[model samples]
Target: MNYETFAPHPNLDAIVKCHWILEVPGDMEAPKQRVIPDGCIEMCFILGDDVKRFNSENEFIIQPRAMVFGQITKPYFVKPTGYVNTFAVRFYPYGFANFITQPIHELADKETPLTSLFEESSIKELEQKIIEAASTKSRIAIIESFLLSRLTDKSIIDNIVTSTIDSLSQTKGSASINSILKDDLSKRRNLERKFSKQVGISPKQLGRIIRLQAALKMMLNKPGENLTQVAYENEYYDQAHFTKDFKEFTGVNPKQYLDNDQMMLSSLIYSKD
Candidate 1:
């Protein structure tokens, strides 16, 4: 397996997180990989063979060749059908909304094909260019051009939303919404409404996801560190609190995460982040 991430163009720095590529050999046998939420959205182009996202023990759906995977609240599993070659754009928590008119919340927890979100002709052309690009640099250039063309207004993101996200990120999701708002607790309801439309999840949910990401990185980097220490460093209430949140998002405890074969892909990605 090979995975790499490239920084986005300076013009797209605010909205686009990075462009990533993943490749796995077709002949290599692999288990179903668990994909946990990381508080962001992605637009992906599958340029190799098909991939399956399992909905049940034996049931699955083939992911679209070109699609937008929205903010997922829980974990899911995907396995390659053959060779895996994909190019994807990872967006900030509130960034994807500026380019589309559809309510972002409506796309949560599922893969919506690009055809359903953009003009069919244009999406087809963009997907073709991404698939045919000769190198990762060329692909980045192609996607940056596509995203810039669609980004009509750079300031479409609500200030309140971005400020709250900035706080959550800086604190590694340890800060509460109330503390962030200070005396303006009355705005909580309004913030939730805006979050649903622009961020695809409530502020609280995004915070938890962000915190989990921090913990995961720590675990991957410091394999010798204990879970209790990891929890303390990340501001979890206790080992129990950390375990509960980890299980909620990853379907496994932190100890199990280190030993689980299924977490290889997730571990690799988070380690890089």
Candidate 2:
């Protein structure tokens, strides 16, 4: 398994997290290469063999070679068909919301083709151009161009949504729903309705997942650090609380996560962030 991440253009620094390229050669089982739950949406283009995302029953189903995965609410698995080569654009926590208008949560637990979501013939051409680009510069240019087209109306971002996003960024995903919702208690139910339509998962759920990424990074950065201390520093109620959140997101305990020799796709992405 080989992974690489490219820095975003200066103009897009606030929205795009980064553009990354991941290539897994044939016979690379990628068994422990788990995609931990993170509150970010990603667009992937497969240049090689088929890949499958398992269902709750562990059933494998073919996913489109080109698709977008919205903020994952839970841990999920991906195994390459053979010699998988994927070029993906990983958006910031709120990045994907800028592109699609329908329910973001529908992207969960399945692969939705770029054709169905972006729908624009131009959008399809942009993805193809990116995948075919010989140099990273060309790929970046393609996405940057697309973003420039979409940002024509920066004012389209609504007040309620942007404020909640500001709250999340301010807390680094550590803030709770009750605290963030204090601004507009009456909008609580309406907020989620908009979130489901625009942001994918509810804001609270996205915050929790984002917080897990933070905690995981703290642990991975200092592999030999004390787990309980790490938990406290991350604001978990206790070691038990930390452990539960960790398992819920990565489907593995911190201790086991530390000792495991296999590379974690999610952790790799988080560390870069």
Write down the TM-score of every candidate.
0.99, 0.87
Q: What would you estimate as the lDDT of candidate 2?
A: 0.75
Backbone clash numbers for all candidates listed:
0, 0
Candidate 2: the clashing residue pairs are: none
Error of 2 at 154 (Å): 2.5
Per-residue accuracy of model 2 over 1-273 as CA lDDT, tens digit each: 567888887877766788888777797666735677777688887878988777754777787877887777767777777887788788775567676677667787556788887656976688779778997678778878877677655454556776887787677677877788876678888888777766678888777776777788887777788989988877788999989988887778988877664446666666766
Give candidate 2 regions above 4 Å deviation: 27-29, 56-58, 261-263
Q: Give per-residue CA lDDT, model 1, range 1-273, as digits (tens).
A: 999999999989999899999999999888999999999999999999999999988999999999999999999999999999999999998989998998899999999999999999999999989888999999999989999888888777999999999999999999999999895979999999999989999999999999999999999998889889999999999999999999999999998889999999999999997
Give the lDDT of residue 11 in candidate 2: 70
- Which segments of candidate 1 are over 4 A away from where they belong? none
Location of the lowest summed lDDT over 10 successive residues in candidate 1: 147-156
